[model samples]
Target chain A: MSSDKNNINLKLKVWRQKNSQTEGAFETLDAKNVSPDASFLEMLDAVNEDLIKKDKEPIVFDHDCREGICGSCGFMINGEAHGPQKGTTVCQLHMRHFNDGEELVLEPWRATAFPVIKDLMCDRSALDRIIRAGGYISVNTGNAQDANNIPIPKPDADEAFMSATCIGCGACVASCKNASAALFTSAKITHLALLPQGRVEQDQRALDMVAQMDAEGFGACTTTGACSAACPKEISLINIAKMNREYLRASVLKKEELSGGGDG
Target chain B: MLNFLKSTVGRKYIMGITGLVWMGFILGHMAGNMLIFLGPEAFNSYGHSIVSNKILLYGTEIALILAIIGHVTSAISLTLENRAAKGTRYAVMPKGEKASTWASRNMGAQGSAILAFIILHLITFKYGAHYETTVNGVVMRDLHKLVLEVFMKPGYVAWYVVCLLLLLFHLSHGAHSVFQSFGILERKMQAPLKKIAWAYAAVVAGGFLSQPIYVFLVNR
Candidate 1:
């Protein structure tokens, strides 16, 4: 592996689009020298600097908290979501992982629900809309409750925490051949459905969030296991299965309500 | 009810249930057909017993038809919806680095082939030339002779074997996926479930293919 002391030269093929309405194309640029210790985003920063000095338009990309925790930065690196590194986000990926004289192609997340807005930025509002539909507990808070007030089993808490690790990045959607949002929708559903506090609105949450997911034009999941593979958090595909169970239960309950034979 | 079926998850639920129903029918059908190895009298007797009761026979036929319809319609809708959702294709598509299988990816094409095979199979076996036989003072359709006649032909036997292989491909993916769709499969249980599905597919396909091979060799 190339270390920080060892610099490498590479060819970068980055997608460049003037705006959402315009067509995008790959712009080849030469990275003459780059520190192996630089993060992937920093490498892009170097390339952008070169473009600005040459009086060319700097490639635009979305990023925040370059530390990889913000969930604000993501783009396809060589047809793989978040580059070739496993469980690492784009911001956390380092130039050292790539070899010298490598040809790298970078593009935004590809999905009908996530349309490209610029060079490497896509509109991810569809995810936000699904969450808005019903991703939260409706509990009103006046004062903080003691952590031990509500007892949660260890396993359930651990699983809930795992499910809650989803960053709402569009990698799952990007990697899926069907562009399915099942993983993303399920992660949110599973996170809330596991906790006692989130159970009160569980049925509604499943129904509304799934409906919103469908409304956003994301494809149906075929359970090919690609989403979980592409997930930066390694979110389990079982979460999608769990969400299916919840959705089925909620649908059946809704049917009962429609027939006037059960509590809505 | 219609709205539920129209939704993606609801449609998947239908597909899962109907696919399982079809799997049940295939297993039972293969077991019954395996009686062919017991000679003409035994095979013919078993066939007669099954079709002897009009209610049981017609009920099963109708249910199978409905299952086929449900499975096909739901699959087509989901496939179309998925295609539309994809919007535009990536210029450079990459193979999934994780657990996707060929059977899982080509379910639509595999399902179509299986449907065509089913149509031809029903036509040749159910509506082809009839033979009558009498055993123990009871009259029965000589299904054993009919199967022999069908398998005696090289073209028919080849087609039957090919169809069985296609069915294996369809079932390999469908069996385990049905469980996943219903959310009945736990995380740890998925690997075992997949193994069971593959084993089931292999056994069913092997069993069905054995008949034609056996008949051909015996007659030769």
Candidate 2:
């Protein structure tokens, strides 16, 4: 143990893959005298810096907006999504959480739908496909409305806002055993379905988006609660139950066009 | 509707509903079988009442078979789908107290074992040996003798108990999972309902388990 706790050396077991088409393997690297306050990604950058000086290929990972709002930079750390700290993204995680000398394992998200593009970076565009299906309100204009114009119940607003917190990170898929995207899809569904502004195409939104999710080849939800626990934003599982209700309602009832309230 | 029927959520609904059907029948069957503890006369008459009406008997049998078909078909389809969805697993997996339970993870295996047991059960008692007896001036199938004979065999009794344990495992996860698939749970009700479902599973499975051991011991 150093008398001055300014610097700590650690071992990292990082996954290394050339590209999406190639096989990947783990490589052990030394991270020497790293600052305790450095973020996890910063530590990775330090290691990459050393690798470059040694004439080795620098480790490649996805990262942006180190503040954790960008929804980028997530991978399994010691088999845990976004590392051991609860509800914290890798960019927000600090080196002080680890032991003076610890070995960490990092891997990309695993799912048939999410193919690994490289070490610690998998293709999450399947999530984009789901949003493209029906993740928006039918707005006449993109401009903001007067905040007081619409009277939304406090509970409903809370529900919608809670669901809206999902940053589209793929940690839920990374943590799930079945690799289901129920949490992510449900959050999107609930984010729109709970507000009057989004009520117009609510039924259609549920149907098309869920269908798109299935088409992406994600597994059926096992309701294991791992996704909620692993979520960096702490999204609730109720969003999933609500989404199921919406899908069922849209499938069973809810005529496509109401076109009503008239005497012909 | 067809799209709903074919979706992953749709299959889950089918599995949950059909599973409920079987759970209802299990409770009824266990209660009816307990008539043996009353006496052969009581047991034989109870069996007679069920089989005397051909329409009702056939109707129950048909519904039960249909439930089995739906449950098993959806189960197999979901199993194949889940296998494909897992893709390539991580070399390093989360250890210690995972979010998935043994029952939730191995529902396919538990359900398959229960299905196999059901077939063997029907053969042993329902179609095994039919003895006739006149009770209260009405002749009826001597189901009591068949049940006693079946339970008297230690091998059959052991197999039956193990299957009941498997049923416990299947129901422990499935009963509460139905609420999730059907979207009938309130946020506050999830935990309490889960506990209630586990209790229900234990009671039904334990009830069935009690009968065979009791009969086997008496026969010995």
Candidate 3:
């Protein structure tokens, strides 16, 4: 609500840790002279500079390409994932949304599956495992084919596009009551299955992706919709339902030999 | 203990365990109810076998009552805690449509609906001639006739059908979750658990509703 850019000051309860093995605690710091136009990461950068000048170790947090596109600058801002804005990523959030002199609680993503690396950094490699198991078109490589060759309908393409927009940031897991990765895994599966290129691997994709998801120790989706609600990318929970449908269909089609796992 | 309850993980742990216990009761109850479709003789014999064994019947009923009480109490507590954490919103128009499942989000509403049906079921089916009527030196009720008579009415049968759908909705989301929450649902069990939940839900819904549908919609 403050139109005047000058009078911004805030307190941040930032979580601090030297390493994953070491214990951590919330270290309070003053966010001084914060510009209204500064992105949330830029504000953090300013604070880090202050800490370095005072002969203190800078707060460790992950950020690459301070733009929202990288999906790296995610941490719980006052118990809400990606800060208070409904759909804005942490990198995209501006100082204006917060009030001057407000105390903000910042913490690393807390989920059993997402082990903290140090401070706000986490090893999101579990998500990568899910992707590796199955998240791609499996067709043999060839030169570019015409878009018309696939003949994908507009509705299907739109749905696929929406699902494919998932940044794999693990916000869904952090926000979920069950810590489910269903939204992310489902998005990857649904995105491919909606297109002709991915149809060849539809059953395989569903089976492998789901297997990997379960293996990663992430909880199942209970349809609470918290993940979708907290997602900075605004990913839909409908993909979870779509994923369920695909899994069911694939299970029905799978032969007894192929039922266990792998391309039998 | 209070600190544990206040933590996010603690609250979820409570919700998960209690939720699973309730789901277990529903599955058992639905399984027993499915026997009704096997015909009056099969269902009545099954019912009499259980009810006639007074000790077992009493113990089972007490356990069921406890499950219901625990489920409702925990649910109320969790709801209150969440509401207190997230302050009242001030949106003038509506925000965008919520992405929650219809069944999961509407637990209280669906629970209330199911509770109404439970009371009605107790009054008309449980307390009516089906139970506690005496002759000479004994108490007895014709279970087969009671079922037939209950389903014979168009309005009563219609209500049964409606309640069965609600029960299905409740069970669909609740079944797999109970196991998952307790960390019992393993990687190997994922497919089977989901399948069993879906199949069990369908069979219960179909089997129980069919009794009334057969009497009112089909036979008539």
Over A1-264, each residue of candidate 3 has an lDDT whose tens digit, in order, gives: 234557599999998877777877888999988888888888898998989999998877777867777777788787667777877788888998888899887877766677778887877889999999989875556888886887889989998898888888887876664566888998899899999889987987887787787667776555566787788778776677667666656655765453567543
Per-chain TM-score (chain B), model 3: 0.77
The DockQ assigned to candidate 3 is: 0.08
The model with the greater lDDT, 2 or 3, is: 2
The CAPRI class of candidate 3 is: incorrect
Residue A77 lDDT in candidate 2: 87
* Rank ordering of all candidates by TM-score, starting from the highest: 2, 1, 3
Candidate 3 C-alpha error for residue A180, in Å? 1.1
Q: How close is candidate 3 to the true structure, as a TM-score?
A: 0.61
Model 2: pairs clashing at backbone N, Cα or C within 3 Å: none
DockQ-best of 1 and 3: 1
The candidate 1 chain A region of ten consecutive residues with least summed lDDT is A255-264
Off by over 4 Å in 2: A1-8, A256-264, B96-98
